[model samples]
Target: MEYITLNNGIKMPIVGTGTNTYGKENKDYNGALTNEIPELVTALELGYRSIDAAISYRNEELVGGILAESSVPREELFITTKIPAREEYVSSKESTRAAIDNSLKNFQTDYLDLLLIHAPIEDKEQLKNTWKVFEEYYEAGKLKAIGVSNFRKNHLDELKEFAKVKPAVNQIQINLKEKNEDLLALLQDEGITPVAWGPMKTEAHQQELLDEIGKAYDKSGAQVLLKYQIQRGVVVIPKSHNRANQAANLDLFDFELTAADVEKIENL
Candidate 1:
């Protein structure tokens, strides 16, 4: 798998599996927990190392258990999870610390490859306190790196007021539908990596365009879309329960898009 170097010098797999709906009934995001994630096992068997999870997904323990039980060693896996900005997890520094500790225990590991605030905190004080705790964990080696998700430029500017460590990534929607070109540029300028979620949520028209682009590379439209993002330095976590699609998602390293193809994709 290919990797991207974050601002803090830590390497992250450019491709990963998203677990937002894994282990849930019928693969529904809001479905009841089934306590088993066969898809995750398939992903691992297919050589996916990076796993993106979140506390709000309500299945961290199950996902963590599956990950821990896998044959892959902890060091080789790039595990990333998030702490929600809700009151329960961010009421105070202690609350945030407890949440992280529970996550570590759930994952059955001493340190996580990366941790992120699931979303922006509107309360400035709460945001500062939460970030401080993240910094503390990072400094103590409990977390390899720390970052935020769904943050806008103003939120980042607010964080810069007293932040000592720059956020390593900003997880956000980056499909052809949402584009988010401006924020993408800002992340580039700040040296923060962009992790794309819902990466396959392209419009039908866009898919047609991507399909046409893929014809030249002998790849699928989904592959073309993911390539467009990763080729421009964005990490993509496109999840699929189908084993073939999972394998196809990691099949991005074998080809390169020419500058003209990239430009066409950019303008699409």
Candidate 2:
């Protein structure tokens, strides 16, 4: 797998598996855990080194269980979780610290590879206070890297005003359909890594282009789309419950898109 060095010098996998559907889709949390535990384990066994999880996903404990049982060593894996921007958690520094402690306990890991504020809250003061707590954890070694998700350029600019450590990443919905080049350029200018959450989705008008490109490389449309994002220097966390699909998503290092091909896709 490819790796990107964060501004803070921490290395993260360029591709990873997102575990958002572990318990959100199903009504029965227990049953969802029963199904998701082995599915996550299967992904690990199939060579997924990074796992993107969140407190809002409500399956960190199940993920922790699989981590304990997997043959993969802890040091080789990259685990990331987020602190939800609810009133109870982000209202004060003490609550934010407790939230981090809770996530560490749920994941059963002493230190997280990365932590992000799930989204911007209504109260800017509360968000800044929460970020202060994240800086503390980063200094204390509880978190290796810190970032934000779903934040616009204005939000980031505001945060930068009072932030001691600028965000290392900004996770957002970046797909073939919504390129959001302006936001991406801003991130680049600010020295923040762009992490794409829904990296594979493509518009109907773009499918023919992806398919034609895939034919040249003997890859699927999904593979070609993923390669496009990686070539553009974006980290992707594609979610899939199927083991075959999970494996296919990771099989992107063999072929590359040419400059011409990238330009064609960009024009679409």
Candidate 3:
């Protein structure tokens, strides 16, 4: 797998697995939790090291248990989990610290690879307090890096007023349908890596075009879409339950898209 160096000099896998719906009944995001996550096991077996999880998903312990029990050592894994912006999780500094501590206990790890505020908090004081707690953990070495997700320019500007550590990444939707061109440029200019969440969401026509492009490289449209994001320095977390598709997602290192190919897709 390829890696992107964050602003803090940590290498994050260019490709990772999104676990928003994993271990849930019928693979539904709101489905009841299941005891086991065979898909996560399959992903790890397929060489996926980056596991993107969030507290809002309500399955951290399950996901964490699988990872703790996996054959892959903790050092080789890049586990990322987010703390929600809700009152229960970020109402105060003490609440925020407790939430993070519980997350660490659930993961059975001394330190997390990356921690992020799940979304932008509207209250400036709450936001500052939550970020301060994150900074505290980061300084103590419990969090390798700290960042935010789903933050826009205004939110980032608010954070800049007192932030000492620049966000390492801003995880956002960056599929073909939602190009997020302006925000992408802003993130690039600010030296923050952009991690695409829905990297495989594309229109049928777009997929057809990507498939046509992939034919030259013996890859699928999904692969082509993921390749397009990573080629431009954007990290992608594209998840699939099918074993074949899971294996295919990691088969991206073998080919490179031409300038013409990139232009065609970019214009699409």
Tens digits of per-residue lDDT for model 2 on 8-97? 999999999998776444534344444456568778988999899998887888787778678898888999999898988898999999
What candidate 3 gets wrong by more than 4 Å, as runs, is: none
TM-score of each: 0.99, 0.95, 0.99
lDDT of 1 by residue, 1-268 (tens): 9899999899999999999999999999999999789999999999999999999999989989998999999999999999999999999999999999999999999999999999999999999999999999999999999999999999999999989999999999998889999999999998999999998987788789889989989999999989988999999999999999999999999999999988887787
Please name the candidate that would achieve the greatest TM-score relative to the true structure: 3
Q: Rate the local accuracy (lDDT) of all candidates.
A: 0.95, 0.88, 0.95
Cα-based RMSD of the predictions, in order? 0.7, 2.0, 0.5
The superposed Cα distance between candidate 1 and the true structure at residue 93, in angstroms, equals 0.6
Stretches > 4 Å off in candidate 2: 23-36
* Best first by TM-score, ranked: 3, 1, 2
Q: Runs in model 1 with CA error above 4 Å?
A: none
Model 1: ten consecutive residues of lowest lDDT: 259-268
Q: lDDT (0-100) at residue 93 of candidate 2?
A: 95
